[model samples]
Target: MKHHDLEILITTRKFFACDAESTEEAVKIATTEARKHLGQDFYSLEIRDPSAGWPETVHEATNPEIT
Candidate 1:
């Protein structure tokens, strides 16, 4: 599979350059990073694996035929 996508929910929405193999794992990492950076005040988080059917970030990758 290709690189995964991760969303870290905090005071402001942010994306982690680090990617996990699965949603469960992604959340784990996000939580850890959040705790370290944003402290325990983080609101929520999201994980998207394009290989697992999650939408791509740039859009075109999801529909390569468009370009």
Candidate 2:
């Protein structure tokens, strides 16, 4: 599969803050709770932990495979 640089918008929650496969997944998980905290705060996903690497690695159009 091709790698996609998805811009994820996260409204503070545990999964997105710790573990999530993708932005869409994170949003889906939060959608129910998000209804209550619509205007809360948000953050872009980042590499905070050492064991992390780019969310996933794959060759995409302009980008080559990381490995």
Candidate 3:
């Protein structure tokens, strides 16, 4: 893959964060450390999964400031 500085957007139900770094360095770090913690199952790891679909559509919208 082409090496570039990029940001990884990581998300969970309760939290989200972005990791910004060079891709080549990031892959080296990710592969090295993840293997230590996850063992041979490193490839199938999942951090979290939130709602699997879109939120219910709201017909009426209300401004939080006005409420």
- Summed backbone clashes in each candidate are 0, 0, 0
Q: If candidate 3 were superposed on the true structure by all CA atoms, what would the RMSD be?
A: 19.3
Name the lDDT of candidate 2.
Answer: 0.38
The models' CA-based lDDT, in order, is: 0.51, 0.38, 0.37
Rank by TM-score, highest first. 1, 3, 2
Preferred candidate (lDDT higher): 2 or 3? 2
Q: What is the C-alpha RMSD of each candidate to the true structure, in Å?
A: 16.4, 14.2, 19.3
7 Cα displacement, candidate 2 (Å): 32
Q: Which 10 consecutive residues of model 1 have the lowest summed lDDT? A: 58-67
Compose the digit string of candidate 3's lDDT tens values, residues 1-67: 7989865434323232335385445444544454465443223322222333444321222223321
Candidate 3: lDDT of 20? 37
What is the TM-score of candidate 1? Answer: 0.39
Q: Scored by Cα lDDT, where does model 1 land?
A: 0.51
Stretches of candidate 1 off by over 4 Å are 1-10, 40-67
Model 2 steric clash total = 0
